[model samples]
Target: MGDLNAKVGREYDGFQGTIGKFGIGVRNDNRRRLLELCGASGLSITNTYFNHKLEHKTTWVSPNGLVQNLIDYVIVNQKWKKSILDTRTFRGCRRVPSDHKLVISKIRIKIQANQEKRRTIKFDVDNLRNERVKQQYEVKVGGKFAALIGMENMDMDSEESWAILSSDTKDVATEVLGYKRINSKPWFSDEAKVLSEEQQRLRVQVDDKQDLEKKQQLKRRRNRKLRELSDRMKHDQNMFWKERATKVAVAMEIGESRAMFAAVRFLRNASQEKVWRGVHGMLDEDGNLVTDEMEKRNLFARYFERLLNVDTTRYWDKKKKKSIADLNEALEVQEEDISAKR
Candidate 1:
C-alpha cells in the first residue's frame, strides 16, 4: 500500500476489478502506467472498494480550493483484496502542511504456521546441449546399463527388472547432468544485491543518528543506492530479453524446429495462454465425463485394457480378406511385367 500519486480515473476499462468506478478525475499517462504495474504485480486499488462521498474519497486539494482529486492510493495484491476491511480519507481539525489528506486502510491477513518444503534441485538441462555434456551423459548411461545387464542375469520378476532399469537410468542422468543452485530472484544481479544491502545499512544508520544533517546525508546515500539498484535491474532485464531474441532468431534461421517453437512461445503472447495443468476428465462407458481422479484413472485403465485385448479374429470377414489378397497379387504381377518391359 502506497501513495503512488496516480490519478486512476472513474473509468476502469482495462483495469476491471483492479481499479473501481469511484476513482476521482480522469486517468492520465501516470494512471495508465500505475494500472499496468498493478496488473503485472497482481495488485488492486483498495480505496475504490468502499462507496464514499467525494470529501472522503479526495486525497488532495489545490491551495485555491478550486480543484480536488484522489491522487493517493492504497493498492494491495489482488488475492488479498478481500482482506482489506475498509479504506477512507480522514481530515484533522488542525491545519496540516501538506496538500494531501491522510488516507488510512484496515487490512487483515493470516500467516500460515507451517512452512513449505524447500525445492533444492534446479536442473541445468540447457547445459546438456553441449557436445561434451552429451558424451558424458551417454558414458554414464552406458555404465549403468552394463550394471543392469549383470542384474538381468539374476533371476528376477518382470516388475523388478523394469524397476531396476528405470531407477538406474534416472540415477545416471541425475549424476552426470547435475542441477545448479536455484536463484529465487534471478533478475536481481550481484551488483543490485550489494547495492540493496548497502542501502539497508545506510537506512539503519539514518535511523540511529540524532543529528538532522547527518541523518539527511545518510538518507541521500540510501536513496542513491536504491536508484542505482533499480537502474541495474532494468538494464539486466533489457539485456536478458535482447540475448533471448537473438537466440530465437538464430533458431528460426537454422530450421531447428523444436528450439524455434520454444523460443517463439517464450517471446510471443502465446506464453500467457492457459495450459492444462492437471489430469483431463475422461468419458466413461455411459458417455458422461468422470472428473474424480480415481474414477477417471480406473475408467481409462478399463478402456485401454478392453481396447487392446479385443477379438481381432472375429472382426474381419474372410470374403473381404480374400479380395484384398487377390488385388495385391494382381498389382505385384503388373508391376513385375512393367519392370521387365522397361
Candidate 2:
C-alpha cells in the first residue's frame, strides 16, 4: 500500500471493472497513468470496493482539518481481489505519528505448517519470572524428569536421553506456564466485539428491509457501531502501546537488552504476506502439460492423497471433490474474525 496522492474519483466509466464506484471526489489527471498501470498489471484498486464511513474513506486530512481525500490505496491482483474482506482508512490510529491515516485491509488466506514433523511449542518463558509460576514449573519439570530417571533398567542412548529430556521439559513448561502465540496486530476488546455483532445484525436488517426509512435507520445504527468499534480499537491500541512503552523504558533502565529488543520487535509491526505455492502448469506421468487450473488442483490433491495415503474406500462415495475455482469462489464471501461474534 502507498500514498499515490492520485484521486481516481467517482467516475469509473471505462475502468469500471478495474476500480469500484465508491471512490471519493473527481478523477485527477494522474488517474490515467494509474489506470494504465493497473490495466497492464491486472491489478485492482481494493480500497474503492468497500463501503465505509467518510472518516474511513479519507486517508489524508489537511493540517487545518478542512480538506480530506482518498489519496492512498491498497491494490491486489485481480484474481486475488476476492480474498480482501475489508479495506478502509482508520482515523482512530494515532500510534504512527503521521499526517496520513492508517489504511488497513483484512484478507483471508491459509498458510499451512509442516504436519509430518512435530514442532515444539514456544512456551511463555517470561512468565517464569513470577515466583509462584517459577515454583510450579520447577515442581512439574522435576517430577517429570524424576519419573524418566526412575526407569533404571532401561538402556537408552545419548540421543534418546537428550530427546526425552527436551520433550519432557517442553511438555512441563507448556503445562505449567502455558504458551503465547506470536502476534503483533492490535486486539479488540469486549465492547468492540459486541458492537461488531450489532453491526452485522444491522447490516442484515438493512439488506432485508424494503422500506427506505427503516433501511436508513439500520444504516445509521451500523454507522454508530462502526464509530464505536473505531473508538474502542483506538483505546485498546493506545493502552497496549502505553503499557509496552512503559515495559521497554523499565527494561532499558534495568539494562535488560533482551526484553527491550523483544518489546521493540513486538511493536515494530512486521509485514507478512501470504506466499502461494502456485501451480503454473503440471506434467502428468505421460509428460503432457496439465494447463487447466482444475486439473492442476486435482493433480495436487492426488499427489497429497498418495503422500498421506488417505484411505479412500469408506468416504470416496460421499466426499465431494473440490477444484481451485471452488476455493477462489469461497474467497468472495465476506469474512470476520472471532471478535465479531457475540
Candidate 3:
C-alpha cells in the first residue's frame, strides 16, 4: 500500500499496509473485511480517521484505507462492559521524533469485581497528553477506536507491546496502522512550484541590484550565497537524521547499518556548516558563542542528553508547554490525593 502525494510532511494515519486517504476504495475493502472479521454493527466507517494535532495541524492519510472506524468496531457495537487497568489507553501523543503521530489505548474487557481477572482488554496508557488531544480531538471518526470505551489494559506483558518493537525496543514504530510500505516524500503542487520559482527570480533580481558594484566580492554575494548555503544545510540535516536512525537500529538490534543512515547524516552535516562571523558568531569582544545562543545550544544539548537516555518525561516538560505526560501526571497526582484522603 505505497502512496504518492503532492502533500508531504510526516502525517500518516490508520495502520500499516493501508494506502491512506489516497486509496479510499482500497481502504474501503480493508474496512469491510475488518467488519466481517469483527462483525461490527451499523457504524459509520466512512469519515472516520482524525487529523494529528501538531504544529502543522496536518490531517493524516489512512494508509491502507483500513476502516479506522472498525478498530474497536466489535467492542463498541456490542457495548461490551470492560475494565482497563491502565486508563491511559485513550491517551494520545508525547511529541516524539516520528514523522506521523500515533494514538494508543489498552482494550481489555473487564467483568464483575468477583469475576476472575481476564487479561482480555487492557494495557498501560503509554501515550502522553498531546497525543490524547490528537486522538480525542480527531475529526469525527464518528466514534471509531472509541469502542475502547469499555475496555481495559489487562495487567500483563502477556504478548508484546501493542505496537511491536524490534528485538530492541528502540526502533519500536507502531505496526498497528498496517502501512504496507515505507512512505515516500511528498512533492509540492504546481502552484507551489510557480511560487517558489517566482521567489527565486525576485531573489536573483535583488542580488543583481544590491551587489552590482561589488558582485565579485564574497561578502557582497550574500543572497546568492544564502541560497547555496541553505541547500547545503538541508543536505547536512538529512544526513544527521539518517545517522540518528542508525542509533535506533542499533538499539533495536535490527542490524540497521551506517549506510542506512548516510542520507540523513549528510543533511545534518551540511546544516552544521554555518559561517557566521561578526555578531552572528556571538563574539563578546573576543568572538565566542554568545550568551543567548550559548544558552539555547546548552538547552538543546541538555535536552538531547535526556532524550538519549530515554528520559522522555524530562525531555518533554523542558518545552514549557502542555503535553500528554504533564496532563497524565497531573491526573495521577489528583487521583492519588483523592485516594489518600478517602
Candidate 4:
C-alpha cells in the first residue's frame, strides 16, 4: 500500500505465508521488519505473489538508472488474498516526476446492493392551467366527493374521511395532470462531442503506438484534436450562458417571477451536476481509484469507524504508564522542596 523501502528479496523461508517466492533482491533489516509485521497481522505481500517482467516488478529506480528496486508493496489480509488479481508497476506513466514507478493492483471484490434512493413525487400541476384538463380534474374529484357524501351515514372516523379524500384527489391529479418529466440539455453541441471523441481516439492510438515516430505523430494529432475540442467547448459554453442570460432578462422584463426563478434554478442545477460528475469517484487508501457507489460508501463507513474508535493501548502500555508515574513522582519531590524553601 506504500513505499516502506523494504527489500524483501526472493526468500520466503520461515515467512512463507507473508512473503512470496517472486520477490527480487536481497533481504534487509527493513524487509525483516516488514515480514514480521505481515506475519503478525496475518497479511500477505500481494506484489510478490504475482509473477511479472522485471520492468513491471521494480517500483523505484536510481537517479542514474543503473539500479532498480522493489520498495513499494501492496499488502492485504490473508482472508482477501485471493482478491488480488494482479499487482505491478506502470513505468509508462508520466503524470508524476519521480524515480518511483506507479504501483497498481487489480482487485476484485463482491459488491452488495446499495440502498435505493427515495424518489420525490412531482405532479405536472402546471398542466392545470389548461381549461380542459382543469375541468376534467374538477369533474372527477367532484364525483368522488359526491359518492363520499352519500356514505356520511356510515359513521366513518375523521382519519378515514381524510384518507379517502386524499386518495381521491391524488387519483384525479394522476389521471389529468400526469407526472413532470425532467430533461436537461447539454451545454456542448454535436460538433464539440465529435471533436471530443476524435481526441480520445487519437489518445488511445498514441498510447498503443510502439514506434517512436508514429507515436510522436499520433501525440501531435491528439494534441491538435484536444485544442480544437477545447475551443469548441468554450464556444458552446459561452453560447449556452448567453442564451440563459437572455431568457432570464426577458422573464424579468415581463415580470414573470416563476420563469425567472426557473431559469435561475436551472443554472444552479447545471453547475451542481458538473461538480457532481467531476467528483463521482475518489481514490481509496491504497491510491486506487474507486468508482462503485457501494464501495465508496463502505470506504467512508470504514474511515469514520476507524476515526471515531481509536485504540490507544499500543501508546498507553505498561512501560509508558510506569515512565509517566516516575516523572510525576520526580515533579512532586521538586515541588515539595520548593515549598519547603518558601
Report lDDT (CA) for all predictions: 0.78, 0.79, 0.38, 0.86
Candidate closest to the true structure, highest TM-score: 2
Query: Can you give the TM-score per candidate against the true fold?
Result: 0.40, 0.41, 0.18, 0.37
Q: Largest lDDT belongs to which candidate?
A: 4
- What's the CA error at residue 241 for candidate 4, in Å? 5.5
Per-model root-mean-square deviation over C-alphas: 27.1, 34.1, 37.2, 23.2
Candidate 3 residues 212-279, lDDT tens each? Answer: 55544533445555565555444443444444544655645765456446544643554344422211
Report the Cα lDDT for residue 142, model 3.
Answer: 22
Instruction: Give the lDDT ranking, best first.
Output: 4, 2, 1, 3
Tell me the tens digit of each residue's lDDT in model 4 across 135-183: 9988999999999999999989999999999999899889889998764
The sequence of per-residue lDDT tens digits that candidate 1 reaches over residues 1-342 is 566778887887777878877777877778878888888889899888788988899888888978888888888888888899989988672275888888889878888789889977656777788999889988888887888788867899999988888888777667877777655444457787898889989989999999999999989888899899877766665455555666887888888989878877765743343322232345689875554556767987998999999877755777678889999999999999999999
Ordered from best to worst TM-score, the candidate numbers read 2, 1, 4, 3
The Cα RMSD in angstroms, rounded to one decimal, for candidate 2 relative to the true structure is 34.1
Mind giving the per-residue lDDT tens digits that candidate 2 earns over 75-172?
A: 99998898899999877788977889988899998768868976766789889899999999888888888988886569988788888999999888
lDDT of 2: 0.79
**Lowest lDDT 10-mer window, candidate 4?**
272-281
